[model samples]
Target: MAFAAACAAVLAAGTAPASAQAEPALTYIWPVHGTIVDHFRPPAHEYGPGNRGLEFATQPGSSFWAAARGVVSFAGPVGGRLHVTVSHPDGLRVSYSGVAGIGVKRGERVHQGQLLGTTADRLHVGVRRGEVYLDPVLIFDGDASTGVRPPLSRPRLVPASTSVYRLQLRWLHSGAGIAVL
Candidate 1:
């Protein structure tokens, strides 16, 4: 009976709280230090008009860095605006638009805090997982002293699916030339 009780105790010890066994949280930083001119506003529908990212008002020539390590999935002009996108290992894709210059190229691996490029008057940073766009403010770590506040809620992660393939095709048709990383 004592041996059986010991076995049960061991089994119970293995079942820890979910938080104790959870995966390490991904750490992200701001791409650029500036005032948030525009906040993320999810569209009513996928194709509806809305601000899908955060817009920072910084000096026109100020340089922006990669928020996290990832591969340069797309770097070029999109709808007349210069953009650079990094596909993070965590399955998150971060796109920096309104760049005045391009420092990285497609398929190039970039480290966190690496120089991405310079922005024009403002920089637009977007984050996505699969087909669902996430709020950049939630993913990034912001300090109140810098005028950036911590995220009020957790981000919802959607699994990657065929929608990702459709997104690539859409970009291709739009002449963005964004290939899978």
Candidate 2:
């Protein structure tokens, strides 16, 4: 169906906002004043073991800042490590792990530079478009982790092999395809 084809296109192009013309502009702060120590590495499949976010080497207890304006979907411990997940506008969500000294509450909206929490040896930051994990570094101007000043390029998405894509193709062939929006 035509609807299914559109859904497939959207998935192939990554989870950009509905209003996205080129790549979606990620207007966000660095969230913490730390050196980039790690980067997002996509796995062969969803739920597989992989580092789906970036890690920043900060002090023992550096406070983390909100990357953009959005509501806090979750802020608590995951596997005993403190974490925060913020649902930003346009179905985008940013998450911070290894946080401490929680200062924000769940369901509370935050701004671009608002304080979120403190960090440990390294802060893990992940960006998600809907349920798909994205490279947190993709939104930044350059790879600060390496201390390089290279020019930034257009945002490119990390391809994911989730069930959604498999189902999309199945639906399109079975005349049951549907758009998520």
Candidate 3:
């Protein structure tokens, strides 16, 4: 009987939810160290082509972060995209574009609210799936300290790009690409 009881306890512990075992993931980070110039805008079409993600106003070399935890399915330079694509465990996929010196190769694991990439100072962001494009603010948790809200119509101050830039350098130094975690 004691053995059975111990087995039950072990099963219970093993099946615990991730949130119960780990700290909650940050839902969003300041896209750039500047006020949000534009808000997350959904595609204009009821069922046609349109913007899929949110847009923030930033200058060249601005840093961007992952809104949540996910696997880095692809990270490299496109013709002009120079983007990173993260696939969340929750079936959500986030993409960051308009970056340069593309860091973080494909197949890496990234934590929530971690730096994804940096972009040229004055660029707009676009996100999309097959046909359903939505606003990015919908996925971000607004912070009063930043003074930005959902349906953001103006700008909000963000943090400096230094921290993420340092992290990116470390990633690039690893050399070996195609990570799983």
Can you give the lDDT of residue 45 in candidate 3?
A: 62
* Candidate 1 structure quality by residue, lDDT tens digits, 20-59: 7866555577788678889999999989999999999989
Clashes per candidate, residues 3 or more apart or on different chains: 0, 0, 9
Residue 124, candidate 3: alpha-carbon lDDT: 48
Better of 1 and 2 by lDDT: 1
> What TM-score against the true fold does each predicted structure earn?
0.65, 0.63, 0.58
Clashing residue pairs in candidate 2 are none
Model 3 compared with the native: what TM-score? 0.58
Measured by lDDT, the strongest candidate is 1
Q: List, residue by residue over 1-181, the lDDT tens digit for candidate 2.
A: 9999999998978876766656455466567777777777888898688888888898988778887788999999889888899997757788998886789999998877787888888899998876787777655544333544334333423232467587667777775466432
RMSD of 1: 15.8
How well does model 3 score by local distance difference test?
0.61
* Per-residue lDDT of 167 in model 1: 81
* Model 2 regions more than 4 Å off: 1-26, 141-181
List the candidates ranked by TM-score, beginning with the highest.
1, 2, 3
- Every candidate's lDDT: 0.83, 0.76, 0.61
